[model samples]
Target: MPVESLPLFPLHAVLLPGAALGLRVFEPRYLDLVRECGRAGHGFGVCLIIDGEEVGAVASAAAFGTEAVIEDFNTGDDGLLTLQVRGRRRFHVHKVRVRDNGLQVADVSWCEADPVEPLQPEHGLLATLLHEVIDKVGGEHSKAPESHFDDAAWVGWRLAEMLPLENAQRQVLLQTGDPHQRLQQVLALLPE
Candidate 1:
Protein backbone atom coordinates (compact mmCIF):
# COMPACT_ATOMS: atom_id res chain seq x y z
CA MET A 1 0.00 0.00 0.00
CA PRO A 2 1.30 3.46 -0.94
CA VAL A 3 1.04 6.05 1.85
CA GLU A 4 0.97 9.83 1.56
CA SER A 5 -0.37 12.82 3.43
CA LEU A 6 -3.21 14.67 1.70
CA PRO A 7 -5.56 17.52 2.50
CA LEU A 8 -8.85 16.02 3.58
CA PHE A 9 -12.23 17.53 2.68
CA PRO A 10 -14.64 15.68 4.89
CA LEU A 11 -18.21 16.13 3.72
CA HIS A 12 -21.60 14.55 4.21
CA ALA A 13 -21.22 13.19 0.66
CA VAL A 14 -19.37 10.24 -0.80
CA LEU A 15 -17.30 10.52 -4.01
CA LEU A 16 -16.74 7.27 -5.85
CA PRO A 17 -13.90 6.69 -8.29
CA GLY A 18 -14.71 7.98 -11.82
CA ALA A 19 -17.62 10.03 -10.46
CA ALA A 20 -17.75 13.75 -11.01
CA LEU A 21 -18.67 16.13 -8.19
CA GLY A 22 -19.56 19.79 -8.43
CA LEU A 23 -18.72 21.98 -5.43
CA ARG A 24 -19.21 25.59 -4.42
CA VAL A 25 -16.33 26.90 -2.32
CA PHE A 26 -16.92 29.63 0.25
CA GLU A 27 -15.48 28.24 3.44
CA PRO A 28 -12.04 29.62 4.20
CA ARG A 29 -10.57 26.26 5.15
CA TYR A 30 -11.70 24.63 1.91
CA LEU A 31 -10.65 27.66 -0.08
CA ASP A 32 -7.18 27.19 1.37
CA LEU A 33 -7.38 23.52 0.46
CA VAL A 34 -8.19 24.31 -3.18
CA ARG A 35 -5.38 26.81 -3.37
CA GLU A 36 -2.92 24.38 -1.80
CA CYS A 37 -3.95 21.64 -4.17
CA GLY A 38 -3.60 23.97 -7.15
CA ARG A 39 -0.11 24.93 -6.05
CA ALA A 40 0.99 21.41 -5.29
CA GLY A 41 -0.56 19.87 -8.42
CA HIS A 42 -2.42 17.23 -6.43
CA GLY A 43 -5.97 16.71 -5.33
CA PHE A 44 -7.58 16.46 -1.89
CA GLY A 45 -9.25 13.53 -0.17
CA VAL A 46 -13.06 13.47 0.12
CA CYS A 47 -14.59 11.25 2.79
CA LEU A 48 -18.07 10.89 4.20
CA ILE A 49 -18.49 12.88 7.41
CA ILE A 50 -19.08 10.43 10.23
CA ASP A 51 -19.84 13.20 12.75
CA GLY A 52 -20.25 16.95 12.79
CA GLU A 53 -21.18 19.16 9.84
CA GLU A 54 -19.51 20.34 6.61
CA VAL A 55 -18.55 23.78 7.90
CA GLY A 56 -16.57 24.71 11.05
CA ALA A 57 -14.79 22.21 13.32
CA VAL A 58 -12.86 19.22 12.01
CA ALA A 59 -15.45 16.50 11.60
CA SER A 60 -14.85 12.80 12.09
CA ALA A 61 -14.84 11.15 8.65
CA ALA A 62 -14.88 7.66 7.22
CA ALA A 63 -11.58 5.79 6.97
CA PHE A 64 -12.11 5.07 3.27
CA GLY A 65 -12.22 7.99 0.84
CA THR A 66 -11.64 9.00 -2.77
CA GLU A 67 -9.07 11.38 -4.12
CA ALA A 68 -10.71 14.21 -6.09
CA VAL A 69 -8.86 16.10 -8.78
CA ILE A 70 -9.99 19.50 -9.98
CA GLU A 71 -11.32 19.39 -13.52
CA ASP A 72 -12.53 22.95 -13.89
CA PHE A 73 -12.90 26.10 -11.78
CA ASN A 74 -14.39 29.54 -12.06
CA THR A 75 -16.03 32.20 -9.99
CA GLY A 76 -19.79 31.94 -9.88
CA ASP A 77 -22.07 34.90 -10.43
CA ASP A 78 -22.59 35.07 -6.67
CA GLY A 79 -18.82 35.47 -6.28
CA LEU A 80 -18.08 32.10 -4.72
CA LEU A 81 -15.76 29.66 -6.42
CA THR A 82 -17.44 26.90 -8.41
CA LEU A 83 -15.44 23.78 -9.10
CA GLN A 84 -15.80 20.61 -11.15
CA VAL A 85 -13.93 17.67 -9.75
CA ARG A 86 -13.61 14.02 -10.71
CA GLY A 87 -12.81 11.15 -8.38
CA ARG A 88 -9.49 9.55 -9.21
CA ARG A 89 -8.81 6.72 -6.76
CA ARG A 90 -9.77 5.28 -3.39
CA PHE A 91 -7.71 5.55 -0.19
CA HIS A 92 -7.81 4.62 3.47
CA VAL A 93 -6.84 7.14 6.13
CA HIS A 94 -4.37 6.00 8.79
CA LYS A 95 -4.00 9.26 10.72
CA VAL A 96 -5.39 12.79 10.68
CA ARG A 97 -3.89 16.14 11.62
CA VAL A 98 -5.87 19.35 11.91
CA ARG A 99 -4.22 22.54 10.77
CA ASP A 100 -4.44 25.88 12.56
CA ASN A 101 -6.87 26.89 9.84
CA GLY A 102 -9.03 23.82 10.57
CA LEU A 103 -8.26 21.82 7.44
CA GLN A 104 -7.83 18.12 8.20
CA VAL A 105 -4.71 16.64 6.64
CA ALA A 106 -4.80 12.87 6.55
CA ASP A 107 -2.12 10.26 6.05
CA VAL A 108 -3.83 7.84 3.71
CA SER A 109 -2.89 4.63 1.93
CA TRP A 110 -4.05 4.44 -1.66
CA CYS A 111 -5.92 1.34 -2.69
CA GLU A 112 -5.10 -0.71 -5.74
CA ALA A 113 -6.62 0.44 -9.01
CA ASP A 114 -9.85 -1.22 -9.99
CA PRO A 115 -9.44 -3.71 -12.77
CA VAL A 116 -11.35 -3.32 -16.04
CA GLU A 117 -13.89 -6.10 -15.96
CA PRO A 118 -16.45 -6.60 -18.66
CA LEU A 119 -20.06 -6.61 -17.57
CA GLN A 120 -21.23 -10.17 -17.02
CA PRO A 121 -24.42 -11.55 -18.57
CA GLU A 122 -26.05 -11.81 -15.16
CA HIS A 123 -25.41 -8.08 -14.61
CA GLY A 124 -26.64 -7.03 -18.04
CA LEU A 125 -29.80 -5.78 -16.38
CA LEU A 126 -27.66 -3.40 -14.32
CA ALA A 127 -26.03 -1.90 -17.39
CA THR A 128 -29.46 -1.55 -18.93
CA LEU A 129 -30.69 0.17 -15.77
CA LEU A 130 -27.76 2.56 -15.88
CA HIS A 131 -28.57 3.36 -19.50
CA GLU A 132 -32.16 4.08 -18.56
CA VAL A 133 -30.94 6.30 -15.73
CA ILE A 134 -28.73 8.27 -18.09
CA ASP A 135 -31.62 8.71 -20.46
CA LYS A 136 -33.78 10.12 -17.68
CA VAL A 137 -31.27 12.06 -15.58
CA GLY A 138 -29.30 13.32 -18.61
CA GLY A 139 -26.26 15.04 -17.18
CA GLU A 140 -22.56 14.29 -17.50
CA HIS A 141 -23.40 10.61 -17.64
CA SER A 142 -25.38 11.13 -20.81
CA LYS A 143 -22.10 12.03 -22.46
CA ALA A 144 -20.19 9.03 -21.15
CA PRO A 145 -18.62 6.85 -23.82
CA GLU A 146 -20.29 3.64 -24.89
CA SER A 147 -17.41 1.62 -23.45
CA HIS A 148 -18.42 2.80 -19.97
CA PHE A 149 -21.76 1.06 -20.26
CA ASP A 150 -19.98 -2.26 -20.87
CA ASP A 151 -17.64 -1.84 -17.90
CA ALA A 152 -18.79 -3.53 -14.69
CA ALA A 153 -17.16 -0.96 -12.41
CA TRP A 154 -18.53 2.03 -14.29
CA VAL A 155 -21.99 0.53 -14.44
CA GLY A 156 -21.97 -0.19 -10.71
CA TRP A 157 -20.70 3.26 -9.74
CA ARG A 158 -23.26 5.02 -11.90
CA LEU A 159 -26.03 2.88 -10.49
CA ALA A 160 -24.85 3.49 -6.95
CA GLU A 161 -24.89 7.23 -7.56
CA MET A 162 -28.19 7.33 -9.44
CA LEU A 163 -30.04 5.13 -6.99
CA PRO A 164 -31.55 6.49 -3.78
CA LEU A 165 -28.91 4.81 -1.63
CA GLU A 166 -27.75 6.49 1.56
CA ASN A 167 -24.31 7.95 2.00
CA ALA A 168 -23.25 4.90 4.00
CA GLN A 169 -24.29 2.61 1.17
CA ARG A 170 -22.31 4.64 -1.30
CA GLN A 171 -19.31 4.41 1.00
CA VAL A 172 -19.69 0.66 1.14
CA LEU A 173 -19.67 0.46 -2.63
CA LEU A 174 -16.60 2.64 -2.77
CA GLN A 175 -14.80 0.38 -0.33
CA THR A 176 -15.65 -2.75 -2.31
CA GLY A 177 -12.29 -3.71 -3.82
CA ASP A 178 -13.38 -5.76 -6.79
CA PRO A 179 -15.17 -4.29 -9.80
CA HIS A 180 -17.18 -7.45 -10.45
CA GLN A 181 -18.06 -7.69 -6.76
CA ARG A 182 -19.34 -4.14 -6.88
CA LEU A 183 -21.75 -5.16 -9.60
CA GLN A 184 -22.97 -8.00 -7.38
CA GLN A 185 -23.49 -5.56 -4.52
CA VAL A 186 -25.43 -3.20 -6.74
CA LEU A 187 -27.57 -6.08 -7.91
CA ALA A 188 -28.57 -6.90 -4.35
CA LEU A 189 -29.47 -3.26 -3.67
CA LEU A 190 -31.91 -2.98 -6.53
CA PRO A 191 -35.62 -3.55 -6.10
CA GLU A 192 -36.53 -7.08 -7.00
Candidate 2:
Protein backbone atom coordinates (compact mmCIF):
# COMPACT_ATOMS: atom_id res chain seq x y z
CA MET A 1 0.00 0.00 0.00
CA PRO A 2 1.10 3.55 -0.63
CA VAL A 3 2.39 5.43 2.41
CA GLU A 4 0.20 8.13 3.86
CA SER A 5 1.17 11.46 5.37
CA LEU A 6 0.09 11.81 9.00
CA PRO A 7 0.32 14.59 11.52
CA LEU A 8 3.25 13.59 13.68
CA PHE A 9 3.92 14.09 17.39
CA PRO A 10 7.66 13.58 18.00
CA LEU A 11 7.89 12.45 21.58
CA HIS A 12 10.32 10.05 23.18
CA ALA A 13 7.69 7.31 23.36
CA VAL A 14 6.81 4.25 21.28
CA LEU A 15 3.41 2.63 20.73
CA LEU A 16 2.86 -0.93 19.51
CA PRO A 17 -0.04 -2.41 17.59
CA GLY A 18 -2.83 -3.54 19.92
CA ALA A 19 -1.39 -1.47 22.80
CA ALA A 20 -3.01 1.60 24.29
CA LEU A 21 -1.53 5.06 24.82
CA GLY A 22 -2.85 8.18 26.51
CA LEU A 23 -2.16 11.82 25.76
CA ARG A 24 -3.02 15.19 27.22
CA VAL A 25 -3.05 17.70 24.38
CA PHE A 26 -2.81 21.45 24.97
CA GLU A 27 -0.76 22.63 22.04
CA PRO A 28 -2.85 24.44 19.46
CA ARG A 29 -1.53 22.51 16.47
CA TYR A 30 -2.19 19.13 18.06
CA LEU A 31 -5.51 20.38 19.24
CA ASP A 32 -6.36 20.84 15.61
CA LEU A 33 -5.11 17.39 14.75
CA VAL A 34 -7.18 15.83 17.51
CA ARG A 35 -10.26 17.77 16.57
CA GLU A 36 -9.87 16.86 12.90
CA CYS A 37 -9.30 13.22 13.74
CA GLY A 38 -12.38 13.15 15.93
CA ARG A 39 -14.45 14.84 13.27
CA ALA A 40 -13.30 12.65 10.38
CA GLY A 41 -13.19 9.37 12.31
CA HIS A 42 -9.72 8.78 10.90
CA GLY A 43 -6.77 7.52 12.90
CA PHE A 44 -3.31 9.07 13.10
CA GLY A 45 0.18 7.65 13.37
CA VAL A 46 2.15 7.73 16.64
CA CYS A 47 5.90 7.69 16.04
CA LEU A 48 8.92 7.53 18.31
CA ILE A 49 11.30 10.46 18.21
CA ILE A 50 14.09 7.86 18.23
CA ASP A 51 16.76 10.53 18.61
CA GLY A 52 16.70 14.21 17.59
CA GLU A 53 15.96 17.68 18.81
CA GLU A 54 12.18 17.86 19.17
CA VAL A 55 12.05 21.36 17.70
CA GLY A 56 14.86 21.00 15.18
CA ALA A 57 13.14 18.32 13.09
CA VAL A 58 9.72 19.77 12.75
CA ALA A 59 9.78 19.44 9.01
CA SER A 60 11.29 17.31 6.27
CA ALA A 61 12.31 14.66 8.79
CA ALA A 62 11.24 11.16 9.76
CA ALA A 63 10.11 9.23 12.81
CA PHE A 64 9.59 5.49 13.24
CA GLY A 65 6.03 4.81 14.39
CA THR A 66 2.71 3.03 14.07
CA GLU A 67 -0.86 3.97 13.13
CA ALA A 68 -3.22 4.44 16.05
CA VAL A 69 -6.81 5.33 16.82
CA ILE A 70 -8.26 7.39 19.64
CA GLU A 71 -10.41 5.09 21.71
CA ASP A 72 -11.53 7.36 24.54
CA PHE A 73 -11.62 11.11 24.87
CA ASN A 74 -12.44 13.76 27.47
CA THR A 75 -12.17 17.49 27.22
CA GLY A 76 -11.18 19.45 30.28
CA ASP A 77 -12.62 22.80 31.33
CA ASP A 78 -9.29 24.40 30.41
CA GLY A 79 -9.75 23.36 26.75
CA LEU A 80 -7.11 20.69 27.03
CA LEU A 81 -7.81 17.19 25.77
CA THR A 82 -7.29 13.82 27.41
CA LEU A 83 -7.52 10.89 25.06
CA GLN A 84 -6.73 7.20 24.98
CA VAL A 85 -5.06 5.82 21.82
CA ARG A 86 -4.68 2.23 20.74
CA GLY A 87 -2.06 1.08 18.27
CA ARG A 88 -3.46 -0.50 15.11
CA ARG A 89 -0.47 -1.24 12.84
CA ARG A 90 3.22 -0.58 12.51
CA PHE A 91 4.85 1.79 10.03
CA HIS A 92 8.32 2.80 8.96
CA VAL A 93 8.64 6.54 8.50
CA HIS A 94 10.08 8.03 5.34
CA LYS A 95 9.87 11.75 5.96
CA VAL A 96 7.81 14.48 7.58
CA ARG A 97 6.90 17.69 5.87
CA VAL A 98 6.49 20.73 8.08
CA ARG A 99 3.30 22.68 8.18
CA ASP A 100 2.70 26.24 9.31
CA ASN A 101 1.03 24.99 12.51
CA GLY A 102 4.20 23.22 13.82
CA LEU A 103 2.89 19.72 13.27
CA GLN A 104 4.87 17.43 10.94
CA VAL A 105 3.18 15.68 8.06
CA ALA A 106 4.74 12.22 8.14
CA ASP A 107 5.13 9.92 5.13
CA VAL A 108 4.94 6.36 6.28
CA SER A 109 4.18 2.85 5.02
CA TRP A 110 2.63 0.06 7.04
CA CYS A 111 5.16 -2.47 8.33
CA GLU A 112 3.82 -5.95 8.21
CA ALA A 113 4.43 -8.26 11.15
CA ASP A 114 6.96 -11.01 10.71
CA PRO A 115 6.23 -14.63 11.40
CA VAL A 116 5.33 -15.45 14.97
CA GLU A 117 7.80 -17.28 17.14
CA PRO A 118 8.47 -18.16 20.74
CA LEU A 119 9.40 -15.43 23.15
CA GLN A 120 12.98 -15.17 24.22
CA PRO A 121 14.09 -15.89 27.78
CA GLU A 122 14.37 -12.18 28.44
CA HIS A 123 10.81 -11.73 27.27
CA GLY A 124 9.64 -14.30 29.76
CA LEU A 125 11.58 -12.54 32.50
CA LEU A 126 9.94 -9.28 31.58
CA ALA A 127 6.56 -10.89 31.93
CA THR A 128 7.55 -12.04 35.40
CA LEU A 129 8.66 -8.56 36.33
CA LEU A 130 5.43 -7.14 34.98
CA HIS A 131 3.43 -9.53 37.09
CA GLU A 132 5.50 -8.62 40.12
CA VAL A 133 4.85 -4.96 39.53
CA ILE A 134 1.15 -5.61 39.10
CA ASP A 135 1.16 -7.42 42.43
CA LYS A 136 2.83 -4.43 44.06
CA VAL A 137 0.59 -1.92 42.35
CA GLY A 138 -2.53 -3.83 43.41
CA GLY A 139 -3.59 -4.05 39.77
CA GLU A 140 -6.06 -6.77 38.94
CA HIS A 141 -3.96 -7.85 35.94
CA SER A 142 -1.96 -10.10 38.19
CA LYS A 143 -4.96 -12.34 38.43
CA ALA A 144 -4.67 -13.34 34.79
CA PRO A 145 -3.67 -16.91 34.01
CA GLU A 146 -0.04 -17.85 33.62
CA SER A 147 -0.66 -18.82 30.01
CA HIS A 148 -1.20 -15.23 28.97
CA PHE A 149 2.42 -14.77 27.93
CA ASP A 150 2.53 -17.80 25.71
CA ASP A 151 1.73 -15.82 22.58
CA ALA A 152 4.28 -13.29 21.34
CA ALA A 153 1.72 -10.69 20.37
CA TRP A 154 -0.14 -11.30 23.60
CA VAL A 155 3.04 -10.86 25.63
CA GLY A 156 3.95 -7.62 23.90
CA TRP A 157 0.46 -6.22 24.19
CA ARG A 158 0.11 -7.31 27.81
CA LEU A 159 3.46 -5.86 28.77
CA ALA A 160 2.68 -2.62 26.98
CA GLU A 161 -0.59 -2.39 28.88
CA MET A 162 0.87 -3.27 32.27
CA LEU A 163 4.22 -1.50 32.37
CA PRO A 164 4.52 1.92 34.01
CA LEU A 165 6.90 3.36 31.45
CA GLU A 166 6.29 6.83 30.09
CA ASN A 167 4.36 7.38 26.86
CA ALA A 168 7.52 7.99 24.86
CA GLN A 169 9.15 4.77 25.91
CA ARG A 170 6.00 2.80 25.28
CA GLN A 171 5.78 4.26 21.78
CA VAL A 172 9.17 2.80 20.92
CA LEU A 173 8.01 -0.68 21.80
CA LEU A 174 4.90 -0.29 19.72
CA GLN A 175 6.81 0.83 16.65
CA THR A 176 9.22 -2.07 16.89
CA GLY A 177 8.28 -4.90 14.56
CA ASP A 178 10.07 -7.56 16.51
CA PRO A 179 8.03 -8.42 19.54
CA HIS A 180 11.09 -10.13 21.01
CA GLN A 181 13.09 -6.93 20.83
CA ARG A 182 10.35 -5.02 22.57
CA LEU A 183 10.28 -7.71 25.24
CA GLN A 184 14.02 -7.55 25.70
CA GLN A 185 13.97 -3.80 26.14
CA VAL A 186 11.12 -4.04 28.62
CA LEU A 187 13.02 -6.74 30.47
CA ALA A 188 16.11 -4.58 30.62
CA LEU A 189 14.02 -1.89 32.26
CA LEU A 190 12.35 -4.29 34.64
CA PRO A 191 12.42 -2.87 38.15
CA GLU A 192 15.66 -3.65 39.89
Candidate 2 residue lDDT tens string, 33-116: 888888888888766665674444453323567777998999877876888888787777787677788877777887877446
Q: What TM-score against the true fold does each predicted structure earn? A: 0.95, 0.72
The number of residue pairs in model 1 that clash at the backbone is 0
Per residue, candidate 1 scores C-alpha lDDT tens digits across 66-127 of 99999999999999999999999899999999999999999999999877889999999988
**Which residue pairs in model 2 clash with each other?**
12-168, 13-168, 13-169, 13-171, 14-170, 14-171, 14-172, 15-171, 15-174, 16-174
- Number of the predicted model whose lDDT against the real structure is largest: 1
Q: Give candidate 1 misplaced runs (Cα > 4 Å).
A: none
In terms of TM-score, which candidate is strongest? 1
Candidate 1 colliding pairs = none
